[model samples]
Target: MSNNVLFDVPGPRARRTSRIASIVTSVVIVGGLFYLYLALEAPRVTANGTETPGMFDPTRWDVITDGRMWNAILVRGLLLGTLKMAAVAAVFALLIGVIFSFARTARSKWIRIPAAVLLDFFRGMPVLLLMLFILLIIGPGAYWAGVAGLAIYNGAVIGEALRSGIQSLPKGQRESGLAIGLTPVQTRLIVEFPQAFRQMLPIIIAQLVVLLKDTSLAYIIAYPELLNIGLRQLPTTYGNRYFFTFFFIVLIVYLTVNLLLSWVARIVARRTASGRKTRRTGPTAGKDEKVGVDTAAMNAVMPDSS
Candidate 1:
């Protein structure tokens, strides 16, 4: 026998609404971009002004195919430098996140207060301003400047994520571990920290995305990232190709990176879920199992031997 219930299946109202919203947003964005393109192209030049090779030359992408302005000066300086800076910043941010996470969870103020203030100070500053300030002191290399800015800002955000996730764990979880004779360090290492990390991972991924985008700001300090390449090319060749160039850069840097990271994250989530299910069902490896004899004893001892 089986027990079940039936109800009317809802029509695809929600799906239809989502489709409508997607269509409307796409229409608006494409229309607005087309309008902006026509508007910009209308009067970009000073009439008979000497076009830089790639600026407003209209020479059929001569600048892009050639890469003259960018290759002339800032090829590796910006393209490769931006990548290195972003990588360094991510490393520093992760390191600072872990350090600050421990600080927030540690037992004493000597750990938390100063760390909190430093974290707060970094997070409070605007990323652009931070980059500018660091660039002045570090003097225009995209590597250190972008890294210093991202480390301070992204690290602060990540630290907060870790701290909040740790705090969000049930208080009883920590106390129970301690009651079993685990020291604060041992309890956090064995139990609370793992749960906290799993919860905070999505947030950390989000911050990494932000940091990667912020790397675009490297051009402001004259570090010559992808945007810098576009900017340098625009003066002479594709001055009016602003929309296309900028959006191309966005698609390349932001969209591609986020999509790839999201895919990897999904895989990780599926693996984690499988591991958790396995742990829940499988008995502890070292536990003693009382099987056939134990079952027979219970049956034999039933009331009235029945």
Candidate 2:
């Protein structure tokens, strides 16, 4: 049996139990899905005394084959509404994250304390409630309300992640910056922030994914985002018979976009890691020189120490 550090390696009996559990869970899930399929295939009747086709019926999904429907849902709803809002919110969130991260990491207690309190407040507030609050104040503009809410909340989250990344670095990194005759602010800006951002990139991307999905919440404020268009507008424009079809499409779009973001994050992280490894072990591996920090630049700006 192989040993493991995180937990004990399963013995024969434990392995058997695990297999049994896995089989049982799989059976339950398949059975549930089968039941749902049958339910959808069953016939339904409408209030107008007319028989309606089941969800699985081919005719009910024919709307998806229409070009106009695609244009309305994909282009207008998804591109113009959801993606646009997410893109804008993401930019603002990143800017806010940088500002808050700096304030949180500042030497002054006055600045750091207030930033901490504001960060906590934003992080603690529910996203939907925040949107609603913004909606009330903004008065009928769901887009800006949703954007502001998402930016503020996700900004606070990203800020904390960045701060943690910076703090997790070895003390020698900061000391080396100081030894090179760099001011604390200059060192932090030039040396520490870039490394911290790279370290925390995965977390930041994950939060942005969350922000993208949260755009659906704007539906509550009457914004014509993906969910709103699919659920309300399309059903009314075409017919309620295609509700599940629209819903399935919306779900798939959300999943696809988020998965793409996760994939991009993985690729970026891998490249950054490889670049760092190369810097440490390239042709100058044994040279007594700083691999990343530019000491000469710091010295040029500082007074010569006799």
Maximum-lDDT candidate? 2
| Candidate 2 residue spans exceeding 4 A from truth | 1-28, 45-49, 272-306
| lDDT, each prediction | 0.67, 0.83
TM-score top scorer: 2
Distance from true position, residue 177, model 2, in Å? 1.7
Task: Name the lDDT value of residue 194 in candidate 2.
Answer: 90
Shift of residue 261 alpha carbon in model 1, Å = 2.8
Query: Candidate 2: global Cα-lDDT?
Result: 0.83
* Model 1, C-alpha of 19: deviation from truth (Å): 11
lDDT of 1 at 120: 78
lDDT by residue (tens digit), candidate 2, 83-186: 99999999999999999989999999999999999988888788888899989976648899999988998888888777776766656778899999999999
Backbone clash tally for model 2?
Answer: 0
- Report the error of model 2 at residue 192, Å: 0.9
